[model samples]
Target: MQNRALAAATFSFVVAQSLCGTLADADWPQWRGPSRNGHSPDTGLMESWPDGGPKQLWIYKNAGKGYAGPAISQGALYTMGTQGEKSTLISLDANTGKERWTTEIGDILGNGWGDGPRGTPSVDGDRVYAMNGGGHLVCASTQDGSILWHKSMSEFGGKTPNWGYTESVVVDGDKILATPGGEKGTVIALNKETGSLIWQSSDITDNAHYSTMVPANIQGQWQYVQRTEKSIFGIHAENGSVLWKTDFPGRTAVIPTPIVFGNRVYVTAGYGTGCKAVEINEKMEVKELYSNRLMKNHHGGAIQVGGHVFGYSDGVGWLCQDLESGEEVWSEKRALGKGAIGMADGKLICVDEGSGKVMLIDASTEGFKEHGSFTLDPQSEIRASRGKIWTHPVVINGKLYLRDQDLVYCYQVQ
Candidate 1:
């Protein structure tokens, strides 16, 4: 009876975890943290960094070459990288800078800007999903880094973008979503357990660009929001039906993930194109709220803290803009160079692209109030002359993770 009772309890625990996602509030298992918004729910973090920055906990110098950011779940960190002509999905110890395992996803991408993978890996309870530069999507065992199922997004007719596919697969419940951008069907949903075709958003087909898709619940309508070079759209999360779309004049690349607040969605791009915000109505339609160049965030995605948005713009440096009014609250070019940013505990954690500097700033709408800053030491020499620090800094479990080409640095930000 005792053994039977123990077995029953174990079964119940596994079932509960599978249904609840088993992801802690502080675990960042997906694209831009828990909510895919570049924000962390962690508190009690340092209000400001010291003169030199937070304490560097440990550094893993063999992370290979890639711009993929690290995602953490259950004390394990997952990221994609490249070694020689092969691309790999790496699993690392979140507390110590030690590699647990690596699964080679596919061939290397030799982009002139940089070579290797571009999208971060998404971690679920016991499995991880990653997409390679050439559009190969792989589902692997998080325990041993063994590939379970691998397929090219091109199979769905997604022609790889010129710069290659930079999308991280989105996993929801039993369906795993991927963008194979072309004509057949842009966004395809596969069975997470079997990698079988579930559905495709055929109603509105736009070729995949560099941006990752974000799941949304607008007016209680479940859908996925995404952007292409020429347009912005949302499709029903249940049946892959086209909900709504709007014309977006995005130039060069549409790389930043769409930011959703309430029923409104905000998107921005680079190469001269600007930003726009649209409201989703009761009938699942869109209404443009405002469009401007106040924040032309390139790949360093922006974050909306409180009621304001913050990011490093092209012509401008760091910027703070009002979310609802679309007004520029303040802009600063001196605090740091062009950089990527993450947010936690009402403070903006940022990294400079050119100088490889990490900074902590107040996420207030008042002004660009920098609290502290530091430079990433021994930066990558393998990067192109124009290639700077492109990896977005990630903060999870009171530790900050930053990566250059082949180097991954972990810092204790608590």
Candidate 2:
């Protein structure tokens, strides 16, 4: 009898663990996963791929694209695209890659590099938020494609950046924050429910750039960190007060989001701008630790794991640097050439910009190690002219999600 009771207890524990794993795999929620950093806490994924790579689960044509990645929430996938002259926000079935709904949000702005919406959509609990290329911001219901509230940055005394508003809205608690650059405010906090202004940053009045805001707990205080053309600053999460400012000599554009580890923050930009690490003191004052040009990431953000930072260096190829001293650890220029990156299960999902080839590499401080790769053959009927596969790949729920113009592809990674 004693042996039978012990066996029953072990069986119950295994069942409970399986249920907990299923619950954690259901959502991707925001721009860069749950923490707003490009890291997914998923396990049980295939560590290596076969010769032809993982099998494509499904592909949805006419999804449109302009470098906007997908935001998965609940059981739906949200992203933005451009159809002719109109900008659209689309929701797709997460499992099958079928279109659930598409809504015309605003007109598209033609740019030199490409066109269409450039920012990733952000989905809260019940509402989906998207910003268009022309500065039109809309909040729509996640269940159905219904607009809840809409506002344009121009109407709020704001002007669009040269490249467009590429920063995904950062939702903190009950407030939504955006960079509406102008005299009114650089960063505006609005009530998530009613779309009313709660507070605005009054310290610096500068035009918006292409970087997104990252939430960080610096020295035991929560703050929002953002980088613009001139500098990088931290604002209080509770009230939008300027906590600290560090002047960075950003040239053509400062596009990459900053990464914070412990009490130090690391920021990088392209077009001659390099990377820097700044230390935050107890009083919210920032001091420069070291600055170097080892990594000049343009817009594709960087991620930190262990004690190294991994990202694409503008002229040096994909590189890794020591997070503390800004020292170059290893640099590899062979696989995936030059492009954006995403991380999942201790591996790097790199998408080559010139060719639509995706490669999986081990995220290591030693050197680059390729485990698998596949060339994406997007259907000719749904391809874009100028912008190919500029959007970054997102891995979640044991699947790899990628976008190329109007086509969104999902492949089973496990």
Worst 10 residues of 1 by lDDT: 17-26
Off by over 4 Å in 2: 1-25, 379-386
Please give the RMSD of candidate 2 to the true structure: 2.2
TM-score of 2: 0.95
lDDT of each: 0.88, 0.85
lDDT of 1 by residue, 163-268 (tens): 8899988999899999997777789999998899898888777878899999999899989998899889988888888899999999878999999999999998
Give residue 340's lDDT in candidate 2 (0 to 100).
84
Stretches off by above 4 angstroms in model 1 are: 1-25
Q: What is the lDDT of residue 261 in candidate 1?
A: 94
Best by TM-score: 2
lDDT of 1: 0.88
Give the Cα error of residue 325 in candidate 2, in Å: 0.8
> Given candidate 1, what's the lDDT at residue 176?
94
